[model samples]
Target: MSWDLSFMFDDLLPALLVGLQYTVLSTVLGYLIALLLGLLIAVVRRVRVVGPVAHGIMEFIRTTPLLIQLVFVFTLVPPTVTPLTVGVVVLGVHYAAYTAEVYRSGIEGVAKGQWEAARALSLPLRRTWGAIVLPQAIRKVIPALGNYLIAMFKDTPLLFAIGVTEMLMMAQRVGQPAGRVMEAYTLVGIMFLLVSIPSAILIRRLERRYAAV
Candidate 1:
């Protein structure tokens, strides 16, 4: 059967955009949560008093599949909390495990001499991290973090399993009446590529920019 490209663009696109808005919102909010929490996890994991416990927790999160975590939250949380909110939190906390590793690597990559120099100057621990180490470490991990952001965007579709009307769910909704599954699915694929490709290119550029520093 011939594809009706016009129907896909004119009818399907708008419906998908509604879902896309939620997808974008989840990605942004979730990535913000992941970025901050991951850094905190990495930092806390370095502390002598709590390092082992933090390490164990991080490993548990890292080992578990994110889909399971999302389902668990959706099942166990109070119904008062919306599925979208639960999705955002699960996505963020799930990705935080991976980002934590990125952060740990970046923090470790900082030259030992820099830490020594900070100590030599009698810098307070907070000042040393804030003024010296973290600035460099965060810069080094920006590209990796961007990659996770894109990954999180793709993962937003999985919210469908939890009854969220994200892009793919909307695509299915759009297709059902028309019996144009191909058109609907194809459009969804194109939309994902449109955003993810440029994002990946930008991340590569960031990688180069930071590497030069």
Candidate 2:
């Protein structure tokens, strides 16, 4: 049949809006986790303070498939817990692997002279990282981190697989009664563009700003 979005606007809009709310919330929480965990991993790698163990952990995460990680987090955990929280946490942890690499590049982008200067000043490791290293690293990585955030936003639809009822799932549910799967799915696509396009633009602006710094 022809694509008619009236059903989506009339009936599914409310539910879709709710789904978007959950999507935004999940993205935010996951982003915070990605940022902190990524920065920590990057710092550990940069200092080489943790030696082989840190390298091993980073390599393991990098090498492994994130979908497998998602499955483990979803099915291996206690079933009593809410899937929404678990989904967000799973997304966070899975993407943190990618974020760790982004952070490492940012950290490495810092000039060697900066590290030498910090060392010569007798700066403590913590102070050097906190005051000198991380500032530059984070500034450099904001665009990359923003990319991860956008990726995480897109992945929120995957939460539907775990029964989180995100946008794609909502569209599927709504389409069943109307037999308008094409319209519903197309609407979902447009909605994603609505959100993701602006996000991408903002990320580009942020990249320009970071580059200027």
State each model's CA lDDT, in order: 0.92, 0.82
lDDT of 2: 0.82
- Candidate 2, pairs of clashing residues: none
What stretches of model 2 exceed 4 Å from their correct place? 47-51
Give residue 23's error in model 2 in angstroms. Answer: 1.2
Please, what are the lDDT tens digits per residue for candidate 2 over residues 158-209? 7887888888888888887878878777778888899999999999999998
Weakest ten-residue segment in model 2 by summed lDDT: 43-52
TM-score of predicted structure 2: 0.91
**Residue 91 Cα positional deviation in candidate 1, in Å, after optimal superposition:** 0.6
Please list all clashing residue pairs in model 1, or write none if there are none.
none
* lDDT per residue as tens, model 1, 1-213: 899989898999999999889999999999999999999999998899898898888788878888888898899999999999999999999899899999999999999999999999999999999999999999999999999999999999899989888999999998988999889998989999999999999999999998866
Worst 10 residues of 1 by lDDT: 57-66
